[model samples]
Target: MFDSVLVAVFTYNEENKISEVLEKMCKKFKNILVVDNNSQDNTLKRISNYPVKCIHHKYNLGKSNSMKTALDYARINNFEYLAFIDGDGQHSISDLEKICNKILDIKNGLVIGFREDLTNLNLKKRIGTKILNKIFTLLYKKKISDIQCGLRVFNISEKSIKWESSGLQHYFADAEITCNAIKNGCQISQIPIQTITSDKFKGMNILQGLYLLIMIVVWRVF
Candidate 1:
């Protein structure tokens, strides 16, 4: 079992689903951390009874910042691996276990849970993800099935610890992380996962997608 792996869930006002997600995570992983992005709801209260570490931000920072917090925590605690899953009830605990097992087997690399079913997403999101995935594949010269899958496992080596992303450009943070990992010569692998679709977990709008495209181009240029 991957006992030393720290499971991190980055949440933002997910009072309705956070409790169930935490309960499932705690069942499989002994160490779990919840990084709350200054939620206004009773999210914190709902998770109070759970035996997990909680980091409440002063403001509603985006997912990138929340992940940075979790990464720092993992480093300080000397955890061997860091597993990140969205606070929304989309990601499956069984998939999480598969990711952890992949990390253990590989010993080093980024293991991403690639959602095979994309029929649930709207047409715009589906197109955007397809284009982004193709772009990433060409840029990194690696087959990246999903550029924005939130469920992932990373080996906490010194070299893999360094990551940078803008709080303003949160939409592409997942892509940025994957790009950095590939650029640094880390092995990237994918495991099939089933996602629970919800309207609450929909992708960005047209303007956000355009901005993300520009940011990705800029990221690749530099």
Candidate 2:
């Protein structure tokens, strides 16, 4: 069991998938947390069935806020590492396990489970990622294949990689973390993982992609 590691699952109306995710995670991990964004569905009730700590919001905070809440919980509870996995069934639990195992061997760093293939994703998602990848390479001088993958693990004690992404950039939080870590000269490792793509697992749209492109430059300079 990962005694010092906290696995946080963020959910919103994920009733259909939450129970399964919690069931698997609970069996594998001792310390698990679920941050629900006032899900109107049975997501909250589904989480209650598992033997994990849960925080239900009064209103629907964005996905990014749930991330902040999870990070705060990890910090307050003194967890050495925090791992994020979506409540939706898109992320691979095996990949998350790989990240946790990898982080344990690192002194301090961020571990991201980059998707191994993108042929099944939407065209916009593919194009958007390519543009962002180009800019990220130019600005950060690092070649990361997937900048917005949510299946990630990082040391909670390392403040340099703490991100300040807000608003609709909820989808861009992972990207911000990568850029911040690179700028601060922190260790970052990307492990290839399989992803299940679907409409429910929405990647950023045109506007969010454009905003993130601009913010990547802002984060690099200021």
Candidate 3:
């Protein structure tokens, strides 16, 4: 078990999937934190069946706030690293295992998982990912294949790479955290994970993609 690490699973109306996800997560992580964004279903009840720490929000506060809550919990409890994964079951627990291993192997490091192929992604998500990746490379001088992959692990004690974790970034937290980590000189390692099937594309809309495009530049400037 990873005693120094806290594996956080973010949930938002994922009752249909949480049981299986939590079942797998509980086996890998001793300290599992479920940040439920006021799921309107039985996600919490399923979570209770597992040996995990659950924090139910009064209302849905978006992914960024959920991330902030997890990070705060890790710091307060003196965990050295914070790992985040989604509860949709799209992200593989095996990939998360690699991330946890990679983070522990390096000092002050952040491991971001990249999908090995993009052919399965829908047109909007596939194209938007390429455009944002190009823009991120231009601004940050780094070519990260997948900046928005949900499965990742990072050192929580390293303050410089922390960046600003609070905002209205409904779906931009992954990219924001990645760009900010690179901008602040955090050690980053990207692992190739199996590309998700098209059926798993949950929130990559035109508006969210546009907002992430703007935020990519915003994080670079301020």
Cα TM-score per model: 0.94, 0.95, 0.94
Ranking by TM-score: 2, 1, 3
- Scored against the true structure, residue 207 in model 2 reaches a CA lDDT of 84
RMSD of each: 1.5, 1.3, 1.6
| Residue 149 Cα positional deviation in candidate 2, in Å, after optimal superposition | 1.1
Could you give the candidate ranking by lDDT, starting with the highest? 2, 3, 1
TM-score of predicted structure 3: 0.94
For candidate 1, which ten residues in a row score worst on lDDT? Answer: 158-167
Cα lDDT tens digits, model 3, 91-128, are 88888888888888895778999988888887887888
Query: Which stretch of 10 consecutive residues in model 2 shows the poorest summed lDDT?
Result: 195-204
Question: Per-model C-alpha lDDT, please?
Answer: 0.83, 0.85, 0.84
TM-score of 1: 0.94
- Rate residue 56 of model 1 by lDDT: 97
Kindly give the stretch of ten consecutive residues in candidate 3 with the minimal lDDT sum.
Answer: 160-169
C-alpha lDDT (0 to 100) for residue 13 of candidate 2: 91
Top lDDT prediction, candidate number: 2
